[model samples]
Target: MAVRVDLNLSLDGIAMPANQTAENPMGEDWGRLVAAYVGTKTMRERVLRDTTGEGTTGVDDRYAAAYFDGVGAEIMGAAMFGLHSFPDDPDWRGWWGEEPPFGYPVLVLTHQQRRTIDFANGTRFEFLSVSPQEALDQALRLAGGADVRIGGGVGTVRDFLTAGLVDRLHVAVSPIVLGQGTSLWDDLRSFDLGYAVTSELSEAGVNHVTFAR
Candidate 1:
């Protein structure tokens, strides 16, 4: 089965989560920018509680690693891949420093033309100007049934979900709250997607909710 997972943070009472990312792990401030999307305090509470401390025993990095262990490829939007424009004068790689999070072949959806970026850890960034379907098809072909992760900045996940391409999801709802920003479901006209909770964990204020579609 094909699967695409999306994750985010938000305020309580809302349906989706917010988008909040600090400059870096240990940056200027403790926590500064707050990009709101959706979700509720209750939801955020659940997600944060599951990603830290003892709750991370069988969760977090281990769980995520296992999920992508033998995975074929990954599909990520260009915006999520980097913060600057492609084909620039200096050519910035990404915000993930040297080693990236994903080690598989990641197809980046972008309109700008650029050559593929190969990292030392075996993750190659292939830019694609085609549609979501095309990128997904390519991912599935390389996935070999393991699992194709739809790493996103929100819009990419919605595209796959609306097209009925996601089969399973592991959403990490954070504890922070952003009063206003882009929402995961803001443009969604319907919520017909059904998901059964497979597993749940609460630790360090992050709730990890795994769902099977």
Candidate 2:
């Protein structure tokens, strides 16, 4: 079982854009940054629940489909779960609506809430305030020997990356340049030194960069 991370980033290495508010939890350029990935046929059927034979069926679709390939459990930050936007709203069940695309256990790391939310489609949100290793421990057990994914909002993924716990990292770098935001490649010079790095340019115009151990 591998510890994996898949994120959409900008060509400038910006994983998240600034100017985030309650109205725009994912930041101003979030949609544009992930436009190519979300436009894939896999995302259309899974996240958007649209299976009308629409959406792009190119190299991006292959990566989109592989995102959920063998992920048994997920670990994410509260921001990725939408808690930063609807912090006071107890009814806010994340941005994934009634049924999230992840059909496994999800560990949400936050210091505020400690509620365990369960969905009918096998997705369970267990809020935990613990270190990355602790969260990974629990998620590994919950994962039942399958691969565990560190789903992110940049900071969370960076934590795991800094700790050297990520077995594989795949970044779908978009073609835009957002000058200000949370940069993903902060403070880690020559991060690719120890890993085998590879790149692929998709027909949708995004570059897929992967660092595998």
TM-score, one value per model? 0.71, 0.97
As a TM-score, model 1 comes out at: 0.71
Model 1, span 1-97: residue lDDT tens: 4666746444331323244344442222213222121122322233333233332233444444454555668998776776333345337686666
Model 2 lDDT per residue over 1-213, tens place: 899999999988999899888788778899999999889889999999997979999989999999999999999999899887778888778888889999899999999866788899999999989999999999999998999999997999999999999999999998899999999999979999979999999997899999999
Evaluate model 2: give its lDDT.
Answer: 0.92
Query: Model 1, 164: alpha-carbon shift in Å?
Result: 1.5
In candidate 1, what residue range of length 10 has the lowest lDDT sum? Answer: 29-38
